[model samples]
Target: MIALNSIVSTFNPDDQQKFITYLQSKNKRRDTKNIQLFKFLIKEELSSKDICKQLYNVVQCNAYHALRKRLFQSIIDFIANNNLEDENSIDMQIIKYILASRTFLLQKNYDVAYKILDKAEKLADENSLFPILNEIYHTKIQYAPYYPKIELKDLINKQQENQKKHQLEDQLNIVYAKLTSLLNAISYKGEIIDFESELQIILNAHNIELQDSLSFKSLYQILAIANISALITTKYYQIENFVLKSYSILKQKKETEKQLFYQIQIVYLIANTLFRNKRFEKSLNYIQEMQELMLLKKGIYLKDFILKKTLLEALNLNYNNQQQKAIDLIEIAISNKHRDIEALLDLHLSLLMFYFQKEDFTVAKSVLSKFYHTDQWYIEKAGIDWVIKKNVAEILLYIEIREEDLLYSRLKSFRRRYKKYLTEIKQTRIFTFLNFAEQYYKNPEGFSTDITRNKIENAFTWTTVHKEDIFVMSSYAWLKSKIDKSKLYSTTLELIKKA
Candidate 1:
């Protein structure tokens, strides 16, 4: 029992051989108990080769059935000792050891089996053992003769390495596919699935050593892309630093295509961040840089498609600042046939604003009428489109003869019926409407007191409650002053002073 414990603890090949020799010298005919003990020792410690040799000798001496029965009992004893009845609970390392033993049991060479099992054990230790074990069990049942020991070992190692490389590549590909799907989903009113956990799983799989290889450089590029998307989705403001680090790594390897892709994404993200922060000119400059890169690439790349949309956004931002360059860019985009319905809609909205600024109500009304009649008008309101649709509502109110009462009632009804939707309305558009309503009431013509009061009050209640919204803060404060001149005036004055 002490010897058996040593064998189990050490698991050394030399210890196994000593047990095999001891078993062979024991009595085979005189004492059945001794013979059984010998067989048990053989099963417990020796390689399958030594066990099989003893079985053959017993059969030659006319004790074949007894030896076979003893061999079966030994197998049962080994399993019992190891407590391995439920193979599912066995650690991958132990399972690989068992597989190695079985390979020798089947009269195959030991070296090939040991190498394969070693690799499997390593993978199992990394908590990535499931796939490898599944493959082994699947192939073990269809056991064939082992003839290619050295070659098979080399091939298995190569394949395992290749599979690891492919997994990283596949993750990068998935990130791009998911980002494109998300953007397109927003365009088409489709739902986006939560991809954060899955992305983290992939990132965790990446090994720094693997990234140093030429074969994995392409995959590293993919990793960079995935990281960018994760940053964008999670609003990780430190994305520029993360991207710059990844870019530096890629640049060190001179991976130009990947570098270009990462650069485009970085530029896009920076432009988007600037736009959100209301840095219109900086956003336009970033978009122009993206456009220049796309032109340099002859418009054949994925970045080109992305830059086209961003260019429209930049133009819209410029138009918001009442710049003529915005109109020039829109005309160029429309004439070049690069403008989709989104860009055209943006252009129409810009033109309406431009006309409004110039007090050309006739052209503004005409342009807005055409915009309201377009297919995009309905498509933009499908609740999935990311662009604000309230702008259309705002324009429609401008041209309609009975707009004041009807528009106010419709907006109020929408707020009450779709309280959740109210949260989704763009803050910029909400503030625009609020400011417009307030200005209309303050007109020298003397607006209706009760109607204007209710409109201002409703806007105030909604906007002030969401006071973190920068666009609506001023309008909210102004409405408060109108509603309660004394208390609100002092509070609003303090708030504005702080701003």
Candidate 2:
């Protein structure tokens, strides 16, 4: 095990000085070797060998190990003696009391144990720590024989109630965890085939009901599950209704920091639903609403929330033919160092699409270089389905730069590698493109034909035909631009206007 002081030192630098001071004051040793050792562990980047030579002046391995164990115990004692009093610390405070009761009861201190247990019971009840409440009830029952004043009837009834509540809480947590796992799985694939039967099985097994007694945590899980279901089946309107109902539940209660965050999250969900449904204007309204809510709160995680909103806004702008504005927003979003690799990948891909559509081949090439540079390793790390979009982006780039040789090579390689992942309809589009590209590049005289025009029109329709496959970039517009011999932005603008 690591020395507790060493683990604590790795925390935020802002807390390091105060923690060090606490350790120094609690050292309580005349030799001061323990204090020196604690200071050495915290500040200096010294190895065990360095410590043996510099601090202890000993080469024996056992000496360093013994010193580390002692330091660990000292830090544990200091942590046990010190307590922080605050709202955030209330749970720990209750836990501390319960632990104290357990220790006192083990030593046969009945009166003291009962006093501590009573205090712990009140704290746990007030905080709705049902699990801890169950523990307290168990401790109460175990000590009931020693306390003559203990009412067996009342204690048993309360214990039964707490146990029931604890069971319900556990069930809800299990369902929530399962829903979260489901979300993660669907995020990569972007679809789940015929989940109706499976959904019924899960629902029946969990006995899930989102009603008045449901806690905010459980309600959030329900909303998440609903969102995932909608995304998998492309049922955006259903999710919108579910979110509205859940938002009503939230508004009926007192506002808190947690509620505020969830409120923003709900609005984001609504915005995304509208965006996916191609109601860009309405989506922008909700995006603005989310921004307004974000302005009222301050937190560390809020940046990620803001970035999400920005990305959605950029998507809205891009699809609405406002490429420059979308590009600007995407640049701003990617400027931040995001911890979410998927979000970063989305931003990079969006930027590539915008620059490519803008016909700024120079900037597009730069973005493509960065995409190619990181995407290979990043996709593996992030576990997202980026290959389809990545290959599509490469084809678009090669087509633009008139790199017929590279385009043919990449097309052949992509077909061989990712054939299984592509749907039949998607594979048909790829084959059509490859055949057209081969003719267009190898024989310029045969580039434009009645057959080519028909293929381009069909490809354009397939964008909506396979809209459910969001992982596919639907490269129909680029093909259309090539067929019509028009600017890519012009074609996109016309299409947006027609929509």
Candidate 3:
């Protein structure tokens, strides 16, 4: 049941209907039970034994298991064929052309063979389909001796040039893989990476040009890496210039229909980067551009980006003094039927932060409670950083409400889980900040606000205001507002304004 249901869950409702049609057309026997199993899987959550009993009117585990295996293979074949015929299958189409040309050439059909090669080469070149272009050139040169009107010297030169282009592609692929490793290190292993310096070294080692080597997909990956690095370091302002420049270069390229997905994500990254830098107006402008782009092609990728768009827009709106609008935006996006669990966790956490800032403790606690799953579950679904934030929020919310027992439990849990990691990463300031909160919660009358503020100012190594992360500042602001005897919401905004 789990095996078949996993594949079936990959299809959207429309695709499920299409799959039904697909099964009906491909059915070999008039009495096949594969379709019945598929429908049952989609519409119910019954166990394998229950499903088997329902389908067979008895416990026929052996027959049900065989049907499941067959259906799984059918889904795999369907997905493969569907992907090949998709509108975004330009590269696959070029490969198909190359294969057809080679077959025709073997049969001594020169007219059709050369014509197909020419067409494939043209499309491959236009799209910067370097890997496919490599195959195309190899085929052309392989048969250069057999075909007439073919300049062997010219074909060799073209192949060499193609090789050089794809060699650069190979280098970029290495850089991408290394960047992914570096990103995972920062995200989960609690390693402090100097991403900008590391990226510079990577580029130098690979001989990749800053401006020329990056194609659309490579640029998006680079931006994503930089964004994650910024997020982990709490220094978003450092990446603002680089992200903007990358997007400006991306804007000049003639974006193909297939590359639209990357373009929308690039735009979102730019908006998010700018928002982190407190450029709310510019961020909103880019978010508006992203919206216009999402409306293209009948909103095919809209659901894929709904949470991202809403999160960025809501953030911008929150900072722009439209707090209710921000809340409304997120609430609508949360109610969306999108099943991206990681993205949903992000939205829930951000909403929790918003309510906490508003000083609505009850609502904030409610929002925090929405993270009803275990810490281990969230760590798997999101990441260590998200789980850390969730734990901190829980502890702080309990502190606010003076729930001593819950606060102690959360404090113990957080220490056991993350203290060693944060300390190892040279992020002890987080511990210092949370400690102050706990101290204040335990003995507000005995807590020395002035001494705590002074200690925070001196003990914590602070970066320049412009380079500090907003969320980091927000966390600090809770202590600041308490020390200065001010409002948490305004203090958070003021810290961002200064930054």
Candidate with the greatest lDDT versus the true structure: 3
lDDT of 3 at 220: 79
Off by over 4 Å in 2: 1-172, 179-197, 209-213, 233-238, 258-264, 288-298, 303-307, 320-322, 336-338, 372-376, 424-453, 456-474, 493-499
- The positional error of residue 259 in candidate 2, measured at the CA in angstroms, is 4.8
Residue 328, model 3: lDDT of: 86
* Structure candidate 3, residue pairs in collision: none
**Candidate 3 residue runs with Cα over 4 Å from true position:** 92-116, 142-154, 189-210, 288-304, 335-339, 370-377, 412-417, 442-456
Candidate 2 per-residue lDDT, tens place, 1-499, comes to 5754446443344334555676678667766566566667666577667776776687656766777787777666554554343223666777889899889988888889989989989877755567888888888888888788788778899999988766766776787677666655544543443454566667779776654334445556667667767755665655665677676776666544434566677778878877766678989998998888876633323555766888899989887767789999989778855556677777887788788888898888888777655434644554434556667777768877898798888888877765654452134556566566656666655655678787666654343432333222335556556667778777765665444
TM-score, prediction 1:
0.44
Which digits, one per residue and each the tens of the lDDT, describe model 1 over residues 267-311?
565565544344556667777776665554334344234424545
Global lDDT of model 1: 0.47
**lDDT for model 3:** 0.81
Ranking by TM-score: 3, 2, 1
Query: In model 1, which regions exceed 4 Å deviation?
Result: 1-165, 175-187, 190-266, 279-285, 297-313, 316-322, 350-362, 373-387, 390-418, 423-499
lDDT of 2 at 88: 36
For model 3 the local lDDT of residue 459 reads 71
